[model samples]
Target chain A: MPSFFTGFELAARLNAETRRRVAALARPPRCVALLDAANAGMAAYARRQQAFAGEAGIVLAPEPYPANPEAVMRRLAELAGDEEVDAVVTLYPLPAGVGALEAALALGAGKDVDGLHPENAGALALGAPARPPATAKACRLIAEELAGPLKGKEIVLVGASRIVGRPLASLLLDAEATVTITHAATRDLAAHTREADIVITAAGVPGLIGAGHLRDGATVLDVSINRGPHGLVGDVDVASLEGRSVTVTHVPDGVGPVTTACLLANIAEAAAGRAL
Target chain B: MPSFFTGFELAARLNAETRRRVAALARPPRCVALLDAANAGMAAYARRQQAFAGEAGIVLAPEPYPANPEAVMRRLAELAGDEEVDAVVTLYPLPAGVGALEAALALGAGKDVDGLHPENAGALALGAPARPPATAKACRLIAEELAGPLKGKEIVLVGASRIVGRPLASLLLDAEATVTITHAATRDLAAHTREADIVITAAGVPGLIGAGHLRDGATVLDVSINRGPHGLVGDVDVASLEGRSVTVTHVPDGVGPVTTACLLANIAEAAAGRAL
Candidate 1:
């Protein structure tokens, strides 16, 4: 049977470290989360974030913004300038017409805990000092933990979204890993995955990858969480790889929890930067 | 015999279009070129830039800044705010300790002709409207001219530098191509290149790739210009692939002129944006 890499232990360890960092600060870091509570994805993430923020000793202030992009920008700018707020993050599933870029621009670069700001993204690509998006950071940490140092490893990344795939590829490249990024337009997905030492997927399509994409003993880090007919599902079809020699991380208890912990850690770090 | 994809024709076509664009505008765009003029690489680029700027109908104002990072930043900020300067670019090899990030940060995003500014880099990565680095743009245009429509094509990029390889990989990804980035840490470079439909190299090492790293009918876009025992050499050894049924771009006239043309084109675009 393939070994499963669960996130519970890692998340706990990270949360503990985050808690310690927050406590060391002169005052509790005030993290203002600007999100629309109406969006299903953002709502779910908010719930997890609130819970995690409490455990990490961060002052979580959830500010509900209107659907208007301008209003979102105004709120972000206000929060960015507010002396009381140490860090800020805007969750995904923003209003239909609103872009994360706009929000990232309005939120100050130093306080952008999610690292959605273009400056942060640019820094990551340029190999400068910057905090990467939490989801990408979580995947990198998980990959490093599972496969030791990523240097010289052949990693096949199945997605090309700016938030996850693009930035994560930059991080992996910084670690000196040989990275191949394949997307929906890729001619043959399996042709790329079959040769990978590790396959990281953020395609957001449940059951998109199966045993056909795996090579024996390869480690798979599934970063997608899609709502399927059978509840939540990951990009990988775990059942197909059952009893295989590969090791994999499942949907709910894998990248998700680790991502939350990483965000909290980022908030703590942002707070520390502000403290300095 | 293999075919050669020279940059002269494409460069002339692009330069003519740039000339037309600049002529249509009410005023000639003033471009500020900041460099030491002492570094050999910067000197060569500056000379070409001055000649191209004249051809493109742009006012090229070369400015020299001190070695201190702060001085570079101050000059960039002044030029960014200068109404007369429509575009700004800082050549590579900025004094030994001066990093590009600082210069990029100080240079306003809209006027960054080279697209070195973090905001522009972020915009390119996010699929937003922004100019990419001129060299990356040149490579993409050359690849597209040789191989129609990059969608679903297998491309192997042989460098990981922030200026060329990383941004070029992002540009290729945006074009919907499957990109494999192999750097100095890659175990077997040939293993990745042999299966590629197109191989774009920016690795500075001369003769790093040859016929052994290619498949029949592969299109190779050599983006490196190394000063070797022979006057100037590219990453690919042309003699090694002399009789192969492949397409290659030679040094001196391969990617160099096209890159200069692209930079002039970008200056036009930036000037046009500022005119609005």
Candidate 2:
């Protein structure tokens, strides 16, 4: 069988390479704010961000906000306007009144490291020269690390959320990869997944991917984090994937840590202005 | 198996009822612009707009702009700035420079009845109340018309393009339906298709959905139009789908017509400032 973890490992390696490249460029240190909701799984994010801080400077401000996005946006806008902040990073499940996260980011576009702003996301989608979303950039880094080059590779994304699936697919397509995105309503999702040289899943459904659903030796990145008896289970069935040339980010260790690191990098880029 | 199309039709009827209730209030008609790409497809769109004009006093302005959206945006902005023009609708295959259609739409948000603008699209994705993209609205309308009430129906969308698949899924999800969006990279796509109550294909691949891929009574909507030897073909195999529980919008008569009509409606809403 071909290597299943090939893509994941490649992504890791590419992430490292990007860091090395950035280091060579003498980029400045950065910080990120991790917004936590009362319902958000913060413990795991804490551990993950700590590891990320070890790699680069990242601050976790676990301020819980109401689901009202307007309130959140007001807070975020205040944060963006602050002199101490370099860039802003947020976890989903935002409180009410904070719905304009993207618009808020636009207010601090240069200082927005996560690339969640509609402007950045839209720019990324159009393949324009713009700051790539941190998570999406990280996802691309992973793809580049596992695969020798992403050009012409068929990549299948198993979610279409703006933060991950849609932006990531746009990034991959911009990289010249044949990209496809599948969501809850997709018909024959497995068929599309089977054809991918790489698969990225962030659907938040634990064990949604199993051996039966994959092609031989396909790289799977389980971006979903399901907290239950298994602690942190990714979208993929890691146990069943044994001996299948698979390499996974072990939900606790994989994308979570990398995502924070990428956030810091994004902040650094925003502060630098030359990052785009 | 169970009849998916019938269920879809039932849901559509319910939606129609809801729409009827909403329409009972005397409100100004919405305006939607159909941005013509100067391609052959424009003629068909114009004819469809004529019929819509008769029904709701909707004004259809088919403006041909270069596929490049930057130039198109300049034109769109000029038109949108006009008091007579309520909403600016530009057809797809946007001119190269039209980098972010969403951004351009954002320029005319209050008037953007189709809701394809990035902010509007994002708002829809977040499940906030906003105008939806015309294609998505048409898809929802078709699904609702075919299905009685969309709640809890298994809908599979083939293709994950932002214009159609992603936004369509968001609309369907808001209507309390289960939606899955699949694209070229999905694995065992047929298995998913066979299980769906409704299938909407926008992959732009001609005849990608065939008889073998569908359930006995699945309702199919082909959102893709392929200029083939037969003139125009949809993503679904229409010939094979005939007489089954499947009711497809033929490439020429199906979604194409509805989308144009919806665009006009969007324009009217934009002009009246009632779409927000």
Candidate 3:
């Protein structure tokens, strides 16, 4: 049977570290969640994030985003200038007219905890000192924790989203891992995955991979969170890999918790950095 | 017989387009080549670039770089403030103390003609509208010119350089190609390259790849400019690929001219953009 890598233990460990760091800080780290509360989904996400922040001794303020692009930019600028705000994260699926890149630029490098700003993104890509996106960082952390050092490891990452796969590619490469970025346009996905020592899936498609798609004893990190009939599901078809020796992380109890913990850790870092 | 893809005709065509665009502008485009003239090799490169800029009816000004990081940043900021300067390109292999990312950040987004700025590099990585690094752009242009559309092709890029290989991976992904980025730490280079539809080599090591390393009929784009006993040489061993059906672009005549032409084109675009 495949050994499932649940994120609960790792999340707890990281949260503990984050809590200790926050306690040492002069003031609680204040993180602004710039999101559209009009969307029930985003509101729920913000509420969930706030719960996590409370546990970490961090203040998570959910600021409603304006629909207008200019107003959105101005709001971000305001947050950036606020000394009390240690970090600002513009939630995805931003109000229709507001652009992701523009919002990141307005949030500025100092407070953009999401690390979506081009400067941070470029720094990550260039192997410079910069905060990487929380989810991408979480993926790396999980992979490294489960497997050994990534140096020279063969990794095939599925899906090339700006938030995840794109940034993860650079991070993995910096770790000296040989990475192949495959997406929807990829012709033979399994051919690449089968040969990879580690397969990371962020395609958001349920039942995307099975035993046949992977080799014996390969480590899989699933980053996709899709709503299934039963509950929240991940990209991989966990049921299909039942009797294999593959090591994998399942959806709900896997990357999700760790991602939240990583975000909190980033907020703590951002707060600690301000004192420097 | 193998088909050799020379950058001459593509460069001439691009140069003609740039010249026409420059002629249509209110005044000749002004480009500043911020380089360390103290380095003889860089000085020769600047001269070559100047000659190309002249053909495109653009003024290429060579600026001597100060060794101090702060002074270098101030110089970049001054150039950014100059209304007369259309584009600014900070040449690589900068003087000892200055950092590449810091210099790129100081160059500012609007005038970064070579597209090394974080904003531009980020935009390119995110598949947003922005200028891409010229060398990466040149490689894509040459590849697309030879291979119809990159929609479903498999490309193996050797070397993970921030300037060329890193940026090229994103561009190739944008074109819908499955890109595998292998670098010095990659254990088995031939294992990846042997099955690739296209092999793009930017690794500076001479004769790093031979006919045995590539698939039959694979297209090779060499971006390295290493000084050989004979003269300039590329990463690919052309003699070893003599009788294959493979398509390739050699070092001196391949990516070099196209990169220069692309830089000139970017300068023209930057100059024209200012009017908007």
Q: TM-score of A-chain in each prediction?
A: 0.95, 0.80, 0.96
Q: Write the per-residue lDDT of candidate 1 for residues B125-181, one digit (tens) a residue.
A: 777787889999999999999998999999999998888888999999989999999
**Candidate 1 CAPRI level:** medium
- Global CA lDDT of candidate 1, please? 0.87
TM-score of each: 0.95, 0.71, 0.95
TM-scores for chain B, in order?
A: 0.95, 0.78, 0.95
Better of 1 and 2 by lDDT: 1
In order, candidate lDDTs are 0.87, 0.63, 0.88
Task: Rank candidates, DockQ, best first.
Answer: 1, 3, 2
Candidate 2 chain A weakest ten by summed lDDT:
A1-10
Candidate 2: segments with Cα more than 4 A from true spot? A1-75, A91-110, A121-137, A147-162, A165-218, A224-245, A274-276, B1-44, B61-74, B91-107, B114-116, B147-160, B169-197, B203-213, B225-245, B272-276
List clashing residue pairs in candidate 3.
none
Q: For model 3, what is the C-alpha lDDT against the true structure?
A: 0.88
Q: Tell me the tens digit of each residue's lDDT in model 2 across B123-183.
A: 5644455667778888898888877788767787887676777677667766756565566
Per-model DockQ: 0.74, 0.12, 0.66
C-alpha RMSD in Å of predicted model 2 compared with the true structure = 6.0
Residue B196 displacement (Å), model 2: 5.1
Best by DockQ: 1
